[model samples]
Target: MATTTASIRVPAPPERVWQLIGGFDTLPDWLPYIPTSELGEGGRVRSLTNEEGGLIVERLEVFDDKGRTYSYSILQAPFPVTGYLSTIAVHEEADAGSSRVEWSGTFTPDGTGEAEAVALFHGIYADGLEALRRTLAAGSAQGS
Candidate 1:
């Protein structure tokens, strides 16, 4: 299995960050690449539409509101991988009201090298965290 993790520190409270990303169906609100998300199975499953109009279905494996974390497994996606499990978490930072957001994933490459899979996911996570930072900055600017 290949794995990767990426994290970013944002100038916001953990609760606030979690409020934006903690939901199973809230990716569209922050992740621009995921343009739409529809929840099913009472919010346990999420069907996402990517910027390319590709379908990615995922099922929530675990969620912790208090911990500001959630884990999911991808049921279907247009990626060269299988058994994909990912987790996203927000942690309170030592600095006043800042928080650290971490995104990590583990998967077995399908017809690909482990290093390639790791690089792909690491890039995704890193880019996603950057997008999150931009989103949060925009929201703060708007007094949200």
Candidate 2:
């Protein structure tokens, strides 16, 4: 299993940031791979994504929102892998003007058992998070 974590400090408050990150259904607007999501427990999530020469199907696993953390698993997707779990956490800053957002995912290759392929998967994880950074930055600016 491989794991990666990416975080960003959004100038927007946690509540507003959650309106973006914590809201699963609107991911496609900011995140490239995620085209759309269905909110709520046991809801269906769909996305328009492509990986390499193949198409990507989006499947989302939603957790009960009780605290400052949310988590889910990718039960179905267009990847050659399984055991996909994604999580997001929101932390309020002491200054009260910003929030710390963190997200991460873990998965295993569906067919290949090679370390190199897994490494490539990890690389994508990093890239995807970086893309989120840009998305959040834009959102923050627009909100301001």
- What are the Cα lDDT values of the candidates? 0.95, 0.64
Per-model TM against the reference: 0.98, 0.68
lDDT of 1 by residue, 1-144 (tens): 888999999999998999899989999888889999999999999999999999999999999998899999999999999999999999999988899999999999998899998999999899999999999999999995
> For candidate 2, which ten residues in a row score worst on lDDT?
46-55
Off by over 4 Å in 1: none
Task: RMSD for all candidates, in order, please.
Answer: 0.9, 3.6
Query: Runs in model 2 with CA error above 4 Å?
Result: 36-42, 47-62, 113-125
lDDT for model 2: 0.64
**1-144 in candidate 2: lDDT tens per residue?**
766677767666778666766665656666686554445444555434443434344455555455566676665555566887767787788878788877777777668664754566556656665676688788768868
Q: Which ten residues in a row are the worst by lDDT in model 1?
A: 23-32
Instruction: Please give the clash total of every predicted structure, in order.
Output: 0, 2
Model 1 whole-model lDDT (C-alpha atoms) = 0.95
RMSD from true fold, candidate 2: 3.6
